[model samples]
Target: MARLKKTVAMVGMMGAGKTAVGSAVARALRVPFLDSDEEIVKAANSTIAEIFERDGEPFFRARETEVLGRLLRGTPCVLSTGGGAYLAESNRRLISEAGVAVWLRADIDLLWQRVRHKTTRPLLRTDNPRETLRKIYEARVPLYGLADIVVDSCPDLSVEEMAGRVIEALRQRPDVLEGE
Candidate 1:
């Protein structure tokens, strides 16, 4: 088994399989899996959409940052973040200092296919969700590019296969994943 030396922060769009693949990776690595969004929801005793509706995005983002920072400082694990979490420079810096970010790159079509029917996404409740998703994708790609590693997501791939691909990428960095 490969040992995870630092937290693996999975960063990408909402439908890019961050939580799914991150959990798989954590299982494979025999580590705990943590989702920042889940933490926020637990703390607030509200769903993400409710948070957005009640307190707005800014407040949710602030809580996200707090959860992320606290989680990253703990033992190494797989951490799945909200889509907008990596957009903040402060969060990015904390991830860089405490862990490695893996951007799950997926096409807009794939993202839409995965998320279209999911009402849980607070950001995609717009009048034209497809167009809204496209706009968000365009705006965030550059920031995601700053991650330490990039794993392209294939629509045809199973969650385990994508997790394998991410683990392969992490293996290249000895500082992150040590020994097989």
Candidate 2:
């Protein structure tokens, strides 16, 4: 079968289901799914918390950049990045130039409902996760809006459904998939 020259990317808040959706999309496209955070963990041989504690966020972020670039260099995989990964100017430009960046949008209320009890996420570290999410959401909304595509997604929807939407959107914007 044929494949898209450029891969698809899912970006949004922490609970936006990028990893889940990206995985499904990759399966649907008969491609691979790569979670940048997971790749980082595998490379560093530690959880994100350990990376943050031992190396600091800046160091972890630098590793994140390298990891993102490395992942992009491989086959066109549907990559699910950390909440702040795409926020970096270099990473954003890399995605925009190389792949189809899709933003998954969800309100803070929905985000809180979905992210509750999700301890694996390092960014939500706070006395009040809801407030932290809200603030982060507000700040990142504009940057997320810069994506090539946007989807209204919440935890209520299955990852497959969201991935279907992403595939459809990218299909519509064939220009983004030029090389493949």
Candidate 3:
């Protein structure tokens, strides 16, 4: 088994499979899997949509940063962050300092296919969701590009296969994973 030395923070657009693939990666690595949004929801006792509807994006982002910082400070694990988490310089710095940020690079079309039906995504609750998704994708890709590692998310790859690819990428970073 490979030993995880730093948290693996998954960053990307919505529907990039951060939660799904991160959980699979954690299972393969025998480490815990955490979702920053989930942590925020838990702490607030409300769903992400509720938080957004009640307190707005800025408030939600603040809570996200707090949850992310707390999670990154814990033992090594796979942490899945919300789509906008990496946009903040503070969050990026915190992740870079305490973990490895892995961007799951998926095309806008694929992201749409994955998230179009999901009502849980508060960001896409727009008048023209497709256009909104595209704009959001365009705006965030550059920030996500700054991640420590990039794993292309292909339509043909199953969740386990994607997790394997992430693990393979981590193997190259000896400081992040060792003891294979």
Candidate 4:
């Protein structure tokens, strides 16, 4: 079995396949898969959209950080975070210190295609969601670039294929993965 030395935090846009690809990566690596969003939802007993609608984004963000820190302090697994998780300096520092951040980079169009029909995204509930997504993409790319590794996403790539790419990228950092 492949040994994971640190938590592999998957950071990217809303539809960048972080959860799907991260789950596959964890399975391939024989590690657990933890999603911050899911954790938050579980703790609050509500969906992310509900959390945002009731308590506000700040509240949700605090919960996100708490969940991330809690998970990172536990086992070395693949952790998928919400799109805005990496934007906060505190979150970035926490992730960098305890885990390795892998940015699943996808183009604006691909991200839009994947998320356009999803009503779960609270951030994209604007008058023009595509434009809103574009703006978000522009703002977050630099922060996402701060990740330790970057795995490019393509429209043609399957979730398994993307997971394979992440595995290859993790292989470059022997301290992160062993017995690859």
Q: What are the RMSDs of all candidates, in order?
A: 0.6, 2.0, 0.5, 0.8
| Candidate 3, RMSD to the unseen true structure | 0.5
Clashing pairs in 2: 5-180
User: Over the stretch 64-162, how does candidate 1's per-residue lDDT look in tens digits?
Assistant: 999999999999999999999999999999999999999999999999999999999889999999999999999999999999999999988899999
Q: Which residue runs does candidate 4 get wrong by more than 4 Å?
A: none
Q: Residue by residue across 1-180, what tens digits does model 2's lDDT show? A: 446778677888888888888888888878888999999999999999899988899999999999988887888878999999888999998887777788988888888888888997677888988788888999999999998888888565677777778777777776644323
Which candidate has the highest lDDT of all? 1
lDDT-better candidate, 2 vs 4: 4
Instruction: Kindly report which residue pairs in candidate 4 clash with one another.
Output: none
- The ten-residue window of minimal lDDT in model 2 covers 171-180
Return the lDDT, model 4, position 52: 95
lDDT of 3 by residue, 73-145 (tens): 9999999999999999999999999999999999999999999999999989999999999999999999999
Per-model TM-score, in order, reads 0.99, 0.93, 0.99, 0.98
Candidate 4 Cα RMSD after full superposition onto the native fold (Å): 0.8
Model 2 spans > 4 angstroms off: 154-156, 177-180
Candidate 4 TM-score versus the reference: 0.98
Q: Report the C-alpha lDDT of model 4 over 65-151, residue by residue, as the tens digit.
A: 999999999989999999999999999999999999999999999999999999999999999999999999999999999999999
Model 3, C-alpha of 155: deviation from truth (Å): 0.8
What TM value does model 2 have? Answer: 0.93
